[model samples]
Target: MSDYVTYDESDHVVTLTLNAPEKRNAISTFADCDAVVEAVRRVNRDRGVRAVILTGAGTAFCAGGDLKAMRDRKGIIEGSHADLRENYRRGVQAMANALYECDAPTIAAVNGPAIGLGLDVACMCDIRIASEKARFAESFIKVGIVPGDGGAWLLPRVVGMSMACELSFTGDQIDAATAKEIRLVSRVVPHDELLPAARALAARIAANPPEMVRMTKRLLREGQHMRLSSLLEISAAYQALAHSTEDHKEAVSAMLEKREPRFTGR
Candidate 1:
C-alpha cells in the first residue's frame, strides 16, 4: 500500500483511499480507471474483509478526470467500433462488476469534491456518506461526453430517471445537503466524521453473519432485472443455501438462548 492508494483493514473493515491529492485525486487516464478496478478486486478478495469504506486522502474524493489528459486524446477517432467497444467495455465492466458483485457492503466516504466519473465511483457503492463540505456533480455533458462508467444505469436506479437526466444534462453541481435530499448520498456529517462514520457503519455490517450478507447482496443485485416469479425462485434457492450454513444454526440457537450470535462465516 505505498500510496497511489492504500487499503487498510482492521476489525473486518477495509478502507481504501485515493492518494493522489495533488491532482485533486483525479483519475485522469485509462490507467487510473484500471487501478480503481484492481483496487476493488483486491479489497473484495481479502477473506477477512467483511466490509469496505472508500475515500480520498486529501481535500477531495476526486475532481473527475484531468482536462489536460482528455485534451490529449481528443483527436483519437482512428479505431474500429468493435475495438473501442471491447477496450473500454472490459475496463468499465470490470469496474462495474467489482462493485455490483462484491460480497460485502461497500461505502463511499466523500471527503470533498466528487464529479463526473468520480460520482460514478460513488454510485457503485452500496452506501454513500458525504462530508458537509462535499460537492458532487455529473459533469460528463460539460465535457461533451456521456457518463461512461455506471452513471447512466446507476444514477437513474439510485435517484429517479428524471433527476438523473437533469443532472446529466445540466452538469450542475450539488452541495452535500442537496445531494442527501435527492438521495444521491445517504448521510452528511462533518468532514472529520466522514471516515469515522463510514468505518462505524462498515464495522456494524461486518459484525453480521457474513455468509448471509453476501448471499443477500447477490440476490438483491440479480433481482433488479428479474421477473417477480423468477426472483421468488432465486430467493428460495438462496434461502436453501443459507439454511445449510453452520452460521445459520448458530443464529437460530442464539435467538433461542436470547444471546448475541457469534458467526464464524462458515
Candidate 2:
C-alpha cells in the first residue's frame, strides 16, 4: 500500500503495519483509512493467507484520529454536518467493515496506546494480544464526539455492555493489565516480546488447513449475530464445504498415519 501502511506476507501469514510513527500511526485522513481497507482486501483475496497480524510500526499501536488534522478541519473532521456523516461512512466506517468482514483470522498486536478508533481497531480483529506497555481507551466522549468508527458496536461485543459503557462514559485510559482483566486482550506480553508472541500465535493458526480456517472464522463471525438454530444451519453448510476440501482428506490421512498434515490450501 502507501507509506502510511506497510504490508508483508510470509509463511501463509500477512502483516499489516501502520507506518506513521510520527503521528503515532493515527488513522487520520481518508487516505490512511483507505490504506487499511486496501490491506484488508488484499489479504482476504489471497487464499494462501491463513492468518493476519495487525500492529503499529513504532511505540503506539495507533493514536486514533490525528488531533492536529481534526483541529485544522483537514480530515474526517472537516465538511458540513451531512457531508461529515457521509465522510465517516465512506472513510473510517468502510475501513471497519473491511476488517470486520475479512475472512482470514486476524490478530491485533497492540504494541502501545490504542485509543479512540485505535481501540475499535483491536476489537475488530478476531483476537487481541497486547504489550505490557499497551494502553486503551474509548475516549471519544472526552473530545465531545461519539465513536464515528463503529466503536459503540464493536467494543460492547468485546468487553460486554457494562464495561463498554463505563469506558465510553469515563474516557479513561486503562493499562494492559486492566485490559486483560476485562477480557479486552487475550494475552499481555513484555513490550519487546509483543510482536514475537503475536507472530507465534499467527504461525499456530497458519499451520491449519487454509480453507477450513477461513470458513471457521466466517462461521464464528456469523454466529455472533444470528440465532442458535440459524447458526447451526450455517455451520452445517460450512462444514460440508470444509469436508470436501482436499486438505481435509489429507488431514484425516495424516492423523491415521500419525504424521504431520501437509495442506496445499485446497
The TM-scores, one per candidate, come to 0.92, 0.98
lDDT of 1 by residue, 1-266 (tens): 23456768899888888888888887654456566677778866776778988898789998876777666642121246776566466655566667656677789999999999789888888899999999999999998988767789999988899999999999999999999999999999998888889988988899888878877887878877889899899899989998999999999999999999999888
Residue 9 in model 2: lDDT? 92
User: For candidate 2, lDDT tens digit of each residue in 1-266?
Assistant: 36787999989889999999988999878899899899988887788898999999888999998888888988887889998999999899999999999889999999999999999999999999999999999999988899988999999999999999999999999999999999999989999999889899999999999888888888888888899999999888888888898999999999999999999987
Weakest 10 consecutive residues of candidate 2 by summed lDDT? 1-10
User: What shift in Å separates residue 36 of candidate 1 from its native position after superposition?
Assistant: 2.2
RMSD of model 1 against the true structure = 2.4
Model 1 accuracy (lDDT, Cα): 0.82
Residue 69 displacement in candidate 2 (angstroms):
1.2
Per-residue lDDT, model 2, residue 110, is: 98
Q: Model 1: which residue pairs collide?
A: none
Top model number, lDDT:
2
